[model samples]
Target chain A: MDKNLEKKVINYGEAIYEATYQEMQRDNNVFAYGLGADDPKGHYGTTKDLHLKFGKNRCFDTPLSEDGMTGVGIGAAMAGLRPIFIHQRMDFLLLCMNQIVNMASKMRYISSGEHCVPLVIRVAIGRSWGQGAQHSQALQSFFMHIPGLKVIAPTTPHDAKGGLIASIRDNNPVIYIEHRMLYKNAGYVPTNSFEIEIGKGRVLKDGNDITIVGVSHTVEDSLRASELLKSVGVNAEVIDPISLSPIDYEIIRNSVMKTKKLLVVDNGWTRCGFSSEIITDVAINCEKITCERLGFADCPCPTTPSLEKHFYPNPSSIAKLANRMCGGNIDWSPPEVVQHEILSFKGPF
Target chain B: MKNQFDIKKAYYLFLLIRKSEEKIIELYNSDKIKSPVHLSIGQEAIAVGVSLALSKSDIIFSNYRGHAHFIAREANLDKMWAELYGKSRGTARGKGGSMHLNDISKNFMPTSAIVTSAIPEAVGYAFALKYKKKNSVVICYHGEGATDEGVFWESLNFASLHDLPIIFICENNRYAIYSHQNTRSINDPIVSRAISFGIDAERISGNSTEEFFKATIRCKEKIKNNSKPQLLECMTSRWQDHVGVTQPELSKEEENNIKKAIKHDDLKNLENKLSKDEVLHIKKRVNKEIEHAIKFAEASDFPRSSELLENVYY
Candidate 1:
């Protein structure tokens, strides 16, 4: 019965598009605007036909001024409109740190709760095609550290739709980080106006030997690693955390109790990052659990395919790390490096 | 603009800001208030005059040196003073100090210290009002220094593009922390850039309350009749230095020029329109008000440590 309720197959980007469509259809006050919002690609098809569906006034494109437009969205959100402000690249958000941190985050607090900013800010992360270091940054850890910000990153098509709905309906500011690579991945999703509760995580593949947890696209890669681990006589559990801030530690704790082992994979850097926080959690919560961390190298991501091959971690690397922790007896040989199209994402970062 | 313009109230506002800023400087040597304050000692007329043209329902966004703007908005002097003192009962509950002074009930938002930040926020606020079909407009105040930021140009374009009900008031005091106007700005007039965005722009002497009031009234009319962004540059001067109570450091010629202008006095313009008895009465009343505010601020307690995390989230 539960399977039938969510029967339709949808890609990650379509799910986001559907969620935006449904949310706009549901609330007249909710509008989506940002750079390339009305472009032909519609921000990697996540915002396609939105301007045509709802008039240009409701869905629109913006100038190159990131900071000013961000403040404009904040002001609009404070005045009873739910604005979904999108940036093609998360790196552009650096220009408007004051708007997001000082203005949008503190508007309600300083107003003593008299004003509420129902804002949904969507940022796309890219990691390939020699986009260079400027375009290949995942600053989720930095944003999550700031107070009054709720960060949500969906790894599945189903969660993408629900998480966005929850973010738009939320009364505070939300930083919705979407991985571009996940936009092409498909899964079963519901067509209704449903919402997944924010600040929650779900176990994808359960096993008794090891618990492997990741966020966004890393979660999908971990699932692939779990399958590979099964062939190697290792039982690897997988988990996808839907939210970063207000992290649902209880789920990870329960998994740790069952497996007695934990490993965290972050989409960003490990230095002073979420992976570090997870390691600390295991040290404090489950003292006996063996642990490891995975993330970007603590340096700028290079552009060439040959250089990028060693730069980012893949499913093979993840499986190899898991094999080491679960008794290094498994035949975990590195696969033949498939010379990917120089343009295939190192991860759209 | 008929005889509705109150000479007494305008002079009273000017005196209120002059006395309050002087008091802040006088007390800065003491350790009682540690927050940085940008004094508008010589630019009181622009705020006082423009405020008379705005309705109580209109919202405002101000820059770092907005003490005079809030004073003209008739913000509670006690709470404002207490805010600078970091008292728990002050505006913004002491979370935002002098830089972010605001009274939402009066539609005066807490100003941001970031240069050019308030410009886009004002445009957004005006956009919201327009979206709701409300007649209320947003007035944004910024310094000449803010014009250098890109968001200022973006906001001007956005406001004009959407025909947002907003009047951007530029407080062109010429010196952005010792960088004179000619040294910092391009040769063309500042108002021309705003006009190029397809919005009406004007330049007025910041010392002339009469001209500033008339300009603001005309802008308000244009905004109400047909939604259009407007810009007004009021060329004023600051008697004191930026961000403190100390004398401004400048080249010898610049300092002499500033001193000569300060010697002309802020009350001289207002005094031309009021009787000697009226000037005396306004000064006496404003001083008493300033004195009471200072006493109240001094008596108030600092924000309790337990409330540190209170406003971090709504």
Candidate 2:
């Protein structure tokens, strides 16, 4: 890191807005559009003032036609325009699966490299406050199972800005998943434009007793868990696998090799989910490694706060699991840490 | 409304598509061409007329039955034949086969196998053209069955709302695979659906190449002048089964309708305007081209096994 480089504390949503604003200013062919792109909220402030800065043609609102609008984005990308398509919720991505999985993902191969879909699909994952089953989902695993798409979920503001810029410049289509809970969480982001490599992982905290890998918002929870683990004398290593598809397996493999124990905390379901994939890959590559996975229980997301609290894995639950994997006492429960994002969120948007 | 030279050129294109598809039927049993083919034997005039009306720079997006549209654009016949034969030198390097054919140099965008999939893409392409202030327009081709898909109406709404420069051509052949339009849709005309979406639309009855050509010219002018999309519901007949070379079995009334359609062939109508020597010259020229394309495809090699994983990503 350069000491002289300028940096500012910005939230994840603002960072994304900055990336879109900068990229649209940098390239004439790049445009952003979705259902509420020009609305006052601007897709939870990720697309704020973009329509004013870039005009309606470049940054506009589209009809409530997910499949058709997705195809439109693919077509525009094939026609030498970079399209940033914003979906307010990741759950709605199911409606455009045909366009995403069949059309955009296969365009390059079906065209034999003659056409490339340089498209960015920005979808936010909602949690808390009765979002229910349809509105809340972290479906990165669905995209990771696909062959042609590049899927990334950045936890911090710095990674969000850099990853979005990289996604916009990537020739192939990219599925960018943002956790709405991480939007208001601020971090030190560089003032200048930058791009973090898509298929790379970052170690938030280095330790030797156990390796705890997290996806999307779970990365933040895992970090808080590391603090609790340290108090118990079980120094844990926390890893953030930023890119789900084309995952940085080598990073997780190395961490598991050194620690000899792995615990994957996913923001989605464990069955046929990203955690299962990580555990399977690690088991195949590493020897004498103990692996456990944690995620939402195999059921629809409940709306009540009490059921939702038990439904999602938090810092205390993560630390308890990590301690159990390390052969430490699992009976001890740490004080619950209330997340500010959850308290601040007043959704049903 | 076109000149004599243009009309003759359109005739040549119409005959070329017809003969090329007929050649496909002739060679399909040989087992050399590995992909399933959807022939447009009786629907060539829609493609030819629209292709003739558009400028060289204009783009086209077509459905699975795209042989006519691909041929009407005067794209490389060698590549098209090679693609059908699954040759390495094909337009898509033998990856897409028949359902997905594209010639970027000719501005004919890749065709889609799924119904209503390419409709929104054409609108998107037209949107890009409008945003960039490009004078080029886009023509999207699909069957009447595509209108049954919800995405079709969604695309129409978006195109009309955005005022994109595009023309949606629905070749209503009265059948989707084995199901007739009567079984599939109600008594409402497909053009009325487009009109309901606030697009200027009309139905072009019969497979008249000149009428389709004139209508496309008028639509092109209107789209460019108003920067809005239009629709043309072209009523035609499918001469064969939806897939493969076999002729479909039809009822006596359907058979009589086919007989009437053959009697009023657009090719024959244009042939009457030309001298016998000119018709012979055009036939010889097209026949020679088709033979060369076949030879090129047969002589081309299959894609290497190592190339199976290639082009899966950028």
Query: Each candidate: fraction of true contacts kept?
Result: 0.58, 0.78
Instruction: State the DockQ of every prediction.
Output: 0.55, 0.82
Model 2 ranges with Cα > 4 A deviation: A1-4, B1-5
- Lowest summed lDDT window (length 10), candidate 1 chain B: B1-10
All candidates' TM-scores? 0.93, 0.98
Candidate 1 per-residue lDDT, tens place, B75-136, comes to: 88898998888887678767777888888777888688778887888888898898788988
Angstrom error of the Cα, residue B164, model 1: value is 1.4
Residue A173, model 2: Cα distance from true site in angstroms: 0.8
Q: Cα miss at A44, model 1 (Å)?
A: 2.8
User: What is residue B305's positional error in candidate 1, in angstroms?
Assistant: 2.0
Which 10 residues in a row give candidate 2 chain A its minimum summed lDDT?
A340-349
How many residue pairs clash in all the candidates, one count each? Answer: 7, 0
Estimate, for each residue in B1-314, the C-alpha lDDT of model 2 and write its tens digit.
24323767877898889999999989999998889999998888899888888888899999789999999999999999999999998989899989999999999888888888888889889888888899888899999999889999999999999889889999999899989888988988998879989999989997998889888998988886885689999999999999999989999999999999999988898889988888899999999999999999999999999999998889
What is candidate 1's DockQ?
Answer: 0.55
